[model samples]
Target: MNTPDTHSPVLEVQSRRRPLAWLVAIALVVLAIDLGSKMWALAELADREPVRLLGGALYLSFARNTGAAFSLGSGYTLVLTLISVTVVGVIIRFASKLRSLPWGVSLGLILGGATGNLVDRFFRDPGFLRGAVIDFFSLFDPYGQVWPIFNVADMALVTGVALAVLLELTGRRIDGTRAVKERKTAGPGTRDKAEQA
Candidate 1:
């Protein structure tokens, strides 16, 4: 059985290196899986029809997307690549500041996903920084064009961002500190006007 954590999140992060490892490990693993799956899709199924993975609900289909999510901004591949590079750079610059588990994991996932796609942008066809990202894995086909086809990297990116949003909503700071609201107390013997009466 797991014991109750008596230490605050910030305290726990400060006391251990394990959380930092978790952040790096998650990023590495996510990057590996995302890229590995993309490689497999490229070699095995690029030209073939969508391979049904689980009934009609999921499929593995090959596509080289030159744009952002849902194939948006298809004409600006280089611009998107530059933006991705900036994002990855910014994330790495702040990687050392990750202290909260949720934030670490969130950033890790985002970093990994960003790196994964960025790799394709660097090396894939159609010249440097203009290469298309290889995506597969279609879902919810029964709904009929309701869900955009995506890949592992995309999955990580979306999940990480969502978790980050939730953490922010609950007043969890990026540095593992809880955002506590300070009560307004009487200061230096000063009192409210009604209390003075």
Candidate 2:
């Protein structure tokens, strides 16, 4: 008996590194952008002055947050610091499993955001592990409402979350698009099928 040809496209589809490499590349790019922007913001808004870049509605106001999202839980810089460190550690440890761009980007955003705030806690005024994160962007409403100030790091975190959600909803596989469809084709409740796909 003769075996089937193994060089055909279908048989050759299982081996590929393009997706993994692309994911890593995108992650690095985002990390660089996040870090660079934060550095620039720190220098440009040194005196905690608000820079009105577009007049009334949008402004770049320098401030600091020593808490979690939306400035909640203030005075917990140590807690926040520990959480950030844990997140970074976890991402680095499991990076090999982040097989898609969205996963990689999410981790990258998280890592960069963590580093950004970590920088403040380590070097900003009030000494090590007690500094507040610098936030500079604000949205003003015509109805007299103001949004919380945020920095580049916050933006990355939000964007990454949004993308991850989108990818998950679309049934996009972490390994690749082919893997996603393959799993679906194998039907539900099949553990082996899911794993191989």
Candidate 3:
């Protein structure tokens, strides 16, 4: 009884609920993989010197960042935790509004990344809400740490935000609707009269 036609329109049913579930699934997966990698890094590379890879362009160095990405807000662990909580909350709110596939992908990445970092912020080290994030991957050493060491979650966050920015520039909304700009038009008679006169 199954046919190709039966499987065709699977992507057509763009309900918000399904996409929201997708978002949650992505978040859980990202959180799991990110945390798992961090654990592996801590166990394997915590005490070792940075291991060069790709001819020293990339290296594995265990770092504990108590602040925002690249240790920017070192003195604001609690504040960053609060901001991350807010990021998670905002993404959850947006999940229920997703109807477009692009929106779903972008929001899912954001949600996943935010949750991944939040887990570290809440349970990694020093104390609650003051724990440091585990960063291990460093890139472009010849460039003098120009890239600022980051983790998988940070990469996801940056990618997601970039996609969102592109979507906004393309006049697409999160609800699967296009923001078409209306242009002014003149009546046929008026246009003709003006031309003729």
TM-score of each: 0.81, 0.70, 0.83
Give all candidates' CA lDDT scores.
0.78, 0.66, 0.77
Report the number of clashing residue pairs per model.
0, 0, 0
TM-score ranking, best first: 3, 1, 2
What number of backbone clashes does candidate 2 have, counting pairs of residues 3 or more apart or in separate chains? Answer: 0
- Give lDDT tens digits, candidate 3, residues 7-40: 2466445465676667777777777888889889
Q: Please say which candidate is ahead in TM-score: 2 or 3.
A: 3
- Ten residues in a row with the worst lDDT in model 2? 176-185
The TM-score that candidate 3 achieves is: 0.83
Residue-by-residue lDDT tens digits, candidate 1, 68-149: 7556688899998999899888877876666677777888898888889889889989989999998887786622265777
List CA RMSD, all candidates: 7.3, 5.5, 7.8
> 31-86 in candidate 2: lDDT tens per residue?
57656766777788766556665666777776778886556678888888788788
TM-score of 2: 0.70
Better of 1 and 3 by lDDT: 1
Candidate 1 yields a Cα-based lDDT of: 0.78
- Give the best candidate by lDDT: 1
